[model samples]
Target: MIEGTDNVSREAAAEAAASSNAATILPGATIGILGGGQLGRMLANAGSAMGYRFVALDPTPDAPMGQVADQIVAAYNDRDAARELAARSDVITYEFENVDADVAAMLMSESYVPQGSELLYTTQHRLREKRAIEAAGVQVAPYSEISSVEELREAVERFGTPCVLKTATGGYDGKGQWVIRDSSESDEAFATLSKAGTQLVLEQFIDFAMEISVIAARSSKGEIKAFPPAENIHVENILHLSIVPARLEDSVLREAERLAIRLAEGLGVVGLIAVEMFVTRDGELYVNELAPRPHNSGHYTMEACRTSQFEQHVRAVCGLPLGDTALLSPVVMVNVLGQHVEPLLERLAVRDEAAERLNVAPKVHLYGKKDAVYKRKMGHVNVLAESTEAALDWINETKIWKV
Candidate 1:
């Protein structure tokens, strides 16, 4: 259950890009990366290491990804700049799934978009994603679309108590989603989104043991690799930690990987895909959702694995040989959210409570953004230990956050 290498037969790959011509995206080739966030920044860094030039597109100046790229295409004026990016780059890949699908639809006419835009289309909308997963023969949480209170009331009657109500679009990190304790709260749940004129997804609440994610990569040549399941914890809907080994039973872990690999191959997905999953109280697995790019759950690999997720993403998208996803160390990753991070540098400087308790090298990655607020993912720090328990303790007590 780890990232792929060149293992799958060529027949398993998409019909068109089966050849191994992907080895040299060539030094002079320019790679276009959509969305200039930290993930894009990391992808651009890996691209530069191979002598490839990069163009990062974003809507604002000083975007994290744009800082390191050869060409910075700011966000506004989507049509004009996208055509330009398609024209200049040999191939294009996106850092986030939220990019305008219409842009990809537009770009497909001119450039080679090996990562199918249809996957983007399906994943961008919650309804479409749930359908795709179900079509792949996977079980997803029971959900119904809601456009008004009347629809939501009917959904509550069908699905019943302890459900989550989420906006059908543009939501993450606990934003645009809420929990309705029972039928009594259905009215408020519906009113909340409906008053604001938002479409919604009312999903049955799951009584799961814990959350886990399998991060995998696939190349155009049908080669696939997967990273081990990462145990994930959330605080106020924001990701707090991702621990590897995931402390999962061998059987459950393998099943998670199987589901991920199946989804990747079934969707004809190219590049990295993170499949978020739920292990129910009965020891059964369920598909929760997906992210069509390198995920926060896989961040520990940068230092603990044989190959970084960023490198694998580039390889898969450009059709290069996949790298080994083997783990070199036990890792504990803590997300440093929002304003709490302003004091991180000072904490590390003091050798205070945080530094004194650590037993292994901790790799801290700051996204270089100055703003902070509750729930904003500003950066993450990873600590490696010999034992999973020890690793967890080190991460919990790191205190990289300021007062």
Candidate 2:
């Protein structure tokens, strides 16, 4: 579904990352990953297939990954626990970026963590990430750092109303953010958000035509491969659905791929990097945010692409040959929030009748989260069909939970 004249060919991308002396990690190596959420769980599943074992360091006991891989039950910042995990692992990678990057650097002196801490440090902070992106010669939304209410007010005045104020660290899924649609809301927004003492960044709101994401991987050998852009839809700041082969013009799709490649190369990311972007009505693209691991948007790749992002990530970190990123089918991926789990399971209990009624195969993925709370990502359903529209139709028909 990609269109455009300036697309980077897959062969050209592989060549750009070519290196003969690059470290080649064979199968059967134990891979240690930080954070044992669903990303770690999926990574473990993918690695296990290639004969690689996995150990995850996470604070959550009985974490999703614990169901599949060995679990080092400890906080990410626990040096002793990290040391234990590292001692048993051949090479380490991480699923979440919010963990202590300094601790990661500390571990680098003792073990082989090819994915490096530099990308984590740069991406974990909003201001720092924007600076890094701009430094790489990429475009981002007009933004300014705000330290105080006065600063927030001034930035609001300059950027105009209808801008977004986000915490510089520890915010996701619509949390730790405020939308100031009018000057009058500035004080309340700043007062409410700044109480936590985290630094903040205010960005001018772009009336984007669509939100899209490009998931790409970079191997230890410097190989780069990008999945086709995914058009994303968000509800209340949470990702609700992802449509692959994004319904974007060829030029915009090509640009998204180029930007993802640039970010992976420029950041020296050894695993996967998901670049979320905004495509304006005028067809201009702006980098919105970056995730230094497998992303929710790329979940469709599990069923729709020749290589899933999880497997590609395992290959990249293991220094194995990168897999092809070609799409196998049109797909729509819908998030299964905590609220959706009960109803979904109930529907499933009814047996083949529900599937027959839906008239489509829904590849359900339950993360095994113990509790289903509002807005928490419990799992997802990847609907594969002949067309994006059909997949989306099935998704709408099958979604029974009230989000």
Candidate 3:
């Protein structure tokens, strides 16, 4: 058994052996995906470029990923559907971490899954993920589990005000989280979140100088490669922009990459892992969280890196040689939320200055969704230039993208 990981069941070990032995699932084979979101869509696009077909199992009908690949419209927990998906593909991976790990384990009975279920299990819950990071000798925020109102109060007292309270599971994009700025608001926040009947974790909020994320990929052959760190800006918990080659001291950048690589190896992950980190005003670094798949912060890699993260994930899971993660240019990727969709579409219909300039050159990707809801990610635009500042300036100049 690998240190810092849960003991693998006999069934899981057999699956790993089968996968490792079947190394080099060359192009033209099908790759099965568990979730069909934007990440899956991008994954399918990358896999298609390599002559590999993709099939996704997601509950949402006509999901973004489904638009690009064959899809099985089934709940992630449906064992029969999972089995069918595994049987039809050369190997399997997931787009998101929220998929049931038990289903992956069931698939392990026969199918080969390079990105094992253990990573999904560890990262699905906030407390478990933090524990795993700490066990790997990584620094994380001080946190405590809160199951009851009293426990929540106690944690609030210990961590003090301005700490964050988050559900142990099923939370993302700022959902299932509350910022407790005062002791008095603890009761209300706890009551509101507890209504969902889930355990919560109270975390000490670090006053970080900046937010950054590193997207790293590990091949089945144990080769690891990391993209340049991306400085992230979030609006109401949703990523607004990602600027590659983050403005940071050289030592800090190197440390971020080192920590990310260390975490990926410690987890024994074969696919991509995005490590989110916080660099304190005092220059101390702390692991914020882990996403065991391609990350939104890495969207810039599509145009800026020698190997896009999406393609890297496909290569890693297929047992192919890992691609170079060298940066090709400074880029800024800005998320296009649903609220901006209408304005963007309207602008594109006419030959206005914004539209005309965008015609000169634009890298707009719109996810085909049925409805436009505020704060929901509809798509993104990547601006590449000589420098990060230049790219961001161009992005800002695009009036239609000023969401």
Candidate 4:
């Protein structure tokens, strides 16, 4: 819960609630963002172009978004700081779903937060998120809730070996999860994950042929638009590449989009929601996870689509009409991790010559992050080509990142 929220004056809360009823937030309104990460940075960039000002609240001084927007360096649950942000902005939104739900609810009551806290609460917990997906008439991997080692062992035995045990909350980027290939590993996996969170879930390991993601935006007026699916590849649990127009049967792509739209409407989202799915060898789709903001996989839309996800997010949260999500080109987005930053920089030094030599030009975007740690996402490159395979081949030929 946000500290000192009870101190808010009744008159102030009433006024904020009134302002939130405005049908649309026009340009020139100040937008407050909750997380000051790369997603917030990109959101600020898009909003700025549309004549909006930004204020960000984050714990990190000079965070990536703080580099561009006015930043209040404070903890997310700081009531005073949150009130300051609410007072200065016409609308508020968060960049990530891991934000404290209680704080988000406080902000919603004190500011115009189109994307409400309920979505955050549901998506932040894996068990709740999976249940929400199932409620939306979408298919998710079969899972069971576990509260103890005995429960986990029982669930694993019921589901069979080669299942996954994951904490219900506070896990991302391959963290807080263990794959139990054999029953022997259940005790260790349970002991390790229980330290992170008491609530756990065990899921059947899916033998997927490929992974894909669809980013959909929904406005307060109930307008929804979905972007093309992007086939994603991960290396060591970090996103490596996102290829647009996922090489799948047209029927499968349609089903993926249909599922995304259904989930978006069912979730009643007022902002962007990225739905990641697993495609089986038999062409079945299973919902893997959901992200309630701009996604890593949707980065390809920046260069390959008529409307970038960043701008679309601004449109969605600001109560404006959703933009056209038509694909403009076949594109591949490659993540530049910490290990590739130096090499990428060296190549960038000779970028013109490299483009000339490779006969492919890649648009590079680097987040102004201070450190270059292993597997940390430093930036991404979008390569638009005649085909997804051609763009992938260009990445391979450049050898900038080990494909």
The models' CA-based lDDT, in order, is: 0.81, 0.89, 0.87, 0.89
Q: Deviation in angstroms for 189 in model 2? A: 1.3
Candidate 1 residues 1-403, lDDT tens each? 1246433444444254444544446566888988888998888887788777888778867788877885555663388898888888898889999898888888888887778689988887778889999987888999999887788888888887878888877787777877887778888878776654556899988899999999989887778999989999887677888988898788999999999998987787889999999999776888988888999999999888998899998888787888999999989888888765766776677654543455566788878664776667888988787766776766556554423
Per-residue lDDT for 194-224 in model 3, tens only?
8878789999999999999999998887778
Residue 254 C-alpha lDDT in model 4: 89
Model 2 lDDT per residue over 185-286, tens place: 999999888976889899999999999999999998888999999999999899998988899889989989999999888777889999999999999999
Model 1 clash number: 12
Better of 1 and 2 by TM-score: 2
* Candidate 3 TM-score, true structure as reference: 0.92
Better of 2 and 3 by lDDT: 2
lDDT of candidate 3 at residue 129, scale 0 to 100: 96
Clashes per candidate (backbone, < 3 Å)? 12, 1, 0, 0
> Which digits, one per residue and each the tens of the lDDT, describe model 4 over residues 164-243?
99999987889989989999998899889999845999999899999999999988767889999999999888889998
Candidate 1 achieves a global lDDT of: 0.81
